[model samples]
Target: MFFTRKKDIVGIDIGSSSIKLIQLKSQKGTYQLQNVGLVPLPAEAIVDNTLMDSASVVEGVKTLIDSLKITAKEAACSISGNSVIIRKISLPVMPTEELEEQIHWEAEQYIPFDINDVNIDFQIIAPDDIDSSKMNVLLVASKKDIINDYLAVFTEAGLKLTVVDVDSFAVQNAFELNYNPDPDEVIALVNIGASVMNMNIVKDGISLFTRDVQLGGSLYNEEIQKHFGVNNEEAERIKISESAADSDRLKDILARANDTLAIEMRRSLDFYNSTAGEGKIGKVYLSGGGAKSAMLPETVSQKLGIPAEILNPFSKVRFDEKEFDPDYLKEIGPLVTVAMGLATRRLGDK
Candidate 1:
């Protein structure tokens, strides 16, 4: 699946809170956004990256496609969270064919799941400069049961699944397309979804490290609900409404939640620095639904001591101002990065 090519495929991101889909048409080397749609899922439709309500997800995807009027049946979707494992390991340098044959054996030592229960794939990265005999490889494995659940949802929704990608890599693709970071700069792309935050560290447009943290927008909602003694729906409404009567209280609650989020992010950054060596992350790009949380960017910047800002996935994509509201797109841009990245794929992309 990693090596196959896909074409005319829409990127469908089945998030815990919403189902987002984006279709892009490549013009020259740049992409033009042809269609975009988002449909919120019923609570608990997808919990912890597991499909708890397949019918709800299927219906959500169908609604998004119908609302967007998207005709493309082929789609690229992504998965993340505890069910997926991505590891960068060093192994003896060898031919591509040999590596392909031996990757399963190498993966056994790193992946905690039984070998037969997981689908494994690997990409050979550049060899180590200091050790001529060793090479770096990126190994991706996901539980077959989880993969099957996604496949079933797509199938039931009447969309052909072209690619199953990890959330971190998908976000990285979107960031590279829009920002085109410098080769020497190490950038951290953090996607804060409903229940997960995927952090991908990239240098020169190549992903060097990736990690998923179990914290996101839901925490803010929980905090707000607890603080205000309101239901989740009411809490979310107050959190998003700037003119709500309890706005000040909501702000304080959100700030505290953001503080906890920042602490977790800082821990992840420290872990990355400790493992990846001395280079500092030049910039931090925040994405996903959690990016909209109040004071999140400032909190992250202050804690990590690195410039942090919300990532606009549409920054480089071509789209008509008349067809879409520029302000609305900008506001939700972070949440669409993974879908936009998935949309960049063609029928035969390597």
Candidate 2:
């Protein structure tokens, strides 16, 4: 028998406001940070997951790759927002080969997009010892046009796209690696990016419910800009750090924005709990640039009546304190959660 090499691949998370680049080396099944970078992009570069400014995105990615001097030619990236759909459904017990042949036909009933215009993939969930006539499966679909856009962007940036995972699954992978939770416990991984919030409810290591809400950190920035009449940069700083004169009003604006997010979370969680039959979520872990808001977790907790905390992806990864500033890594910890998850993936992994 012969063994194959597991080629190294960089993780690139292209967000609407910034591009995150992370490189990791695995030693004995543990991850070691080799290089990390964060590059800001124009707001118009990717408006709502649509690659509007491909040139700017390509330039940003190229600059990061050049600055970090990443020699890896393969990469794993992720996509989110309106164009992607994830659903968990039950199907009649079938063999793996048969399931593979008919997945597209099964996906058509649940997917809203034209069957011919989307790419589909699925994973079969194993059942307990108790015999059952049906099996649970997770169906993921993404528009072909969006896939083409990413392919073009990466081809121009001089990298091979090896794996395409969803933002929600990436967060889950990171969480599992960092915090080995109880199998019986429930977890709600809330990843709030610049323009979209992905809420994934996991039970026994299975995704039971997932939803993408069009609300995120941008809400706070918009409110701050409108109230103070400041530019986007200043608004972002004020929202994150409260480094301004109108402390009282700034707090109010942030609370107002958080209200929108909190209400939405409450509604969605309630709906899932009532319908999915999954037990109450043990806790909610927030990760994203939006999770950096000073009072976001608290606001969400108070509104939802469930504990919420910021997810620190570096909790279990190895890195030198001298090579990376601990304070800086801590500050950007939440923002890199998705990239960390992507970096952990090896070729041909599920």
Q: Name the TM-score of candidate 2.
A: 0.96
Model 2 clash pairs?
A: none
Alpha-carbon lDDT, every model: 0.86, 0.87
What local lDDT does model 1 show for residue 1?
A: 40
Q: Compared with the true structure, what per-residue lDDT tens digits does model 1 show for residues 1-350?
A: 44244467899999999989889998888998899878888899988899999999999988988888888889898999998899988999999899889889989999999999999888887788679999988899999998888888899999878788889988888988888676899998999999999998888766788889888999988987787788988877877773356777767888888999888888988888888853779899999999898789999999999999999899989999999889988877887888998888765553
RMSD list, candidates in order: 1.4, 2.8
**What count of clashes does model 2 give?**
0
Global lDDT for candidate 1? 0.86
Q: Compose the digit string of candidate 2's lDDT tens values, residues 87-147.
A: 8778888998899899999999999989999988888876532458888888899998998
In candidate 1, list every pair of residues with a backbone clash: 5-347, 5-348, 6-346, 6-347, 7-346, 7-347
Error of 1 at 149 (Å): 0.7
Q: In model 1, where is the ten-residue run with the lowest total lDDT?
A: 1-10
User: What is the C-alpha local distance difference test score of candidate 2?
Assistant: 0.87
